[model samples]
Target: MAVRARAARTGVYQYAGREIDPDNTHGLRDTAVVNVLRDESAVFDERAVRSFIGKPITDDHPSQPVTADNWRTHARGTIMGAMRDGEYLAFDLMLTDAPTVAKVNAGKRELSNGYACDVEIGDFTAPDGTKCQARQKPGSIIGNHVALVDRGRAGSDCAICDALPSNLFDTLKTEKPVKTMVIDGLTVDMANADTAIATVQTLIAARDAATGKVTTLEAQTVADAATLVAKDAEIAKLTKALADAKPTLQQLRDAGKAFAVIEAKAKANGVAVTDAMDEAAIMKAVVDKAMPGNTYEGEHVRIAFDALTKDTKVDQPKVQPIGAPAQITDAHTDYLNDRAKQRAALSSAWKTPFNAADAA
Candidate 1:
């Protein structure tokens, strides 16, 4: 069988660790042999065909750096065996097939994993009024309302909701208009807190009544309600305070002054500030103003660079060195003069002189 022969020769043969033979263990079938016999002209021209025909085939070895356009066509079935059924093949292999494989892969990955929604349930409806479904995707048709489903099992309904975003489910649970609110330092227009509170209150009330301790819970509920009222009053007061404090020039100046004070403190402590402040210039200015030049003036004495470099005038006459008087003896002076003449000539000749020169 031509297929069997080709597969035996080419499938998965590794010079190193790289799979050379791309076709799986299944070699050429009888059909391929029949095709080759039927179309001798086409078969003769193909390089893969020549290799199969037992001719001398040139195997241009593959490397990681080789260009994809020039990559050898590998066996199709063999590649499938290496990868998962549904998972994508890596671009490292596909760079040979299509140079844009990476881009295509990126698009596919985005479609598969990136498009997300936190849909909130608005309502549930069914034809029979028995089985109902809630649309809970946040930006979906309906949002932030509870969908009452009568027919579906609670577990199934909950599971379906779980498959949706956590945020959407949470939003649905707290279904109402999102009023602007602050928690910690962050500004948020979150899901309605009132709806959530009412829902919780209703649940608690129902549970207490069913358990026959409604009267006992009544006292706790009153206490909780009082506490909540106090909290609301406090929040309202703060909100009013914030609202009253409108942006003014004076307020801005006060903020700037406060910032300056903090900045000064930071600089004094040698805290590293950003380039916005020009720390180098500020430091130079500080040095120039606070500790300019190497001069120290104490309480009793003043010291400065002028004191060191200033010219001093002496109050006494200059004295010359006392030595023997110069008396020229003809023999000694002439010998010295001759020696000087010879030394000068020698000095001029060599461009330098030794300690003593030869006397004429």
Candidate 2:
């Protein structure tokens, strides 16, 4: 009988009393021979024959092997169960293989609908000396298994975990949503409803101010128009009154001619007329300064006196003087008679002289 060795197991397998899987197995299969050296010098050496028999390992074994084809499905099922059990950090499916990680990522991407899922892969080492890559929510702690972010519901630690402060959870539960409005295609969130209402009121106030200014301007324009109308009416009345009071040209010329005659009469009478005196005053002064007979009343008195005293004869005659000649021219008559006698005597003497001369 020859001694024989049994074949080793490679993949996951089940035996009669135990189970073997890839988790506990390693190394490939190869053939080797057992060699024994003999020495003939010693008296005690003897040839020995042994008979050994064992069952050969066969492919007739139950296995649940993890491979690339079904690793995603198994990993997803495992992670889902761990999440439900609150043991989400226990498994590291990301470090298994590239294809397995890809499948896992795809499944994670499908978890959040219409939103981007930010799943973080972290390096971890299992207790069994295997390198692992685990999936977790972004910014999450390892042991808490809940996200460390401040969502509206206090993340996943509000109800059961109690990892946050007691007052913080109460505040989050009672907080109200912010007020929002859409302006020019952008959403604006206000602190409160009062703030949004105040903005609207500001706009209304500005519009009212503009309207008031326009109204004031219109009123001013109307007032100015009324004032202009009143001024035009007053001007028309004054123009008519002036036309009624003004003197005509012919009347002024006649008054000037009458004044010239009065001035000339006053000058001829030496009445001392001046530019300051009017026509009636200068004529009155001229009449007052006239000579008594040259006055209008004096002329009538003189004419009556002349009519009474005219053509009256004397009442008495004078007697003739004693021995006086009846003619009053006697002296002149005696001188003329003496002159005639003298002439006659001279003529007679002249004739005698002539006669004597002729007799001689």
Candidate 3:
């Protein structure tokens, strides 16, 4: 509860006329706080001033209003009347209640004025170059009562506002600086600029990280494609090598069989053959032994082999007689071999040169 004073020039209350320092510990505003001239005019208006005149003074404000009906029970004095005193609207009062006068005479003399008003909230510099957050609007000020207290807010010197600032507002809103943000061509209202900026920065960092991952994946894809191409080329090369080897393998098998025949013919012709002898040397030996006096190119050695084997082929039986059995008998088998020389000559016939074309 704010207090007031009882004095001759400064009785209980005044309007306009309240001043609070910016550096005051109350922390009301950032500059000297005062009422506007227009609001002062309203406070001193005939109806407003009359409402204050003759109002009761109490030891302290009652819980309810002290009207004419209740003044006898609550009044310690009376706010007799008021008038303009320089920039201030000063009041006069009469202390009629004995007990309250005793308290004041006993040095408890501070005063408080109780009033009602509709506060108009704003920030503005006062006529004396002070700042205030609010002032009483025109025609909205009315006097209720005055009270004597231990301490006064707006002293007789009018150094503070009269109304209880703590209860003046319907809802107290602690003001914070408003900030704005622009996103995708739209403006957004924000309570904190620093937090918004930090959030945007975090989002940008996340986007960059995702972009880096995509770039790495793209590069990896290209490398994988190149590796696949190399693998395909290697597979193609191996396939071609296999294809080129097919005919060479057939030729190698044919040459090995030809040499085996030459070695057989050389032994049959009584030309000494040894493991150390190659196909060409064995062929020459066979030719020299069979022709006895001829010296010929290596190709002529085949004539000697044909001459030696001409009499060796077994002929088919003349024609099976009507009575002959379909399965072979010992007599038929006997015609296939000279039993006495079979063991010695069998390898020669079995290793004979094969004609792949005739078999196919």
Best by TM-score: 3
Using alpha carbons, what is the TM-score of model 3? 0.33
Report lDDT per candidate.
0.31, 0.34, 0.59
Report how far residue 360 has shifted in candidate 3, in Å. 99
Q: Please provide, for model 2 over 36-155, each residue's C-alpha lDDT reduced to its tens digit, 9 standing for 90 to 100.
A: 111111101111100001111111111222223323233221111111112111111112234433543343111100111222223444334444333223322112111111221211
User: Candidate 3 at residue 236, lDDT?
Assistant: 83
Q: Which regions of candidate 1 are displaced past 4 Å?
A: 1-219, 230-234, 241-245, 275-360
Model 3: per-residue lDDT, tens digit, 212-243?
Answer: 78756654554455356557767887899888
lDDT (10s digit) by residue, model 1, range 4-39: 110111001012111111121222222121110111
Off by over 4 Å in 3: 1-39, 156-360
TM-score of 2: 0.18
Q: Candidate 2: count the clashes.
A: 0
Clashing residue pairs found in predicted model 3: 3-152, 4-111, 4-112, 5-111
- Which of candidates 1 and 2 reaches a greater lDDT? 2
**TM per prediction:** 0.16, 0.18, 0.33
Clashes of 3: 4
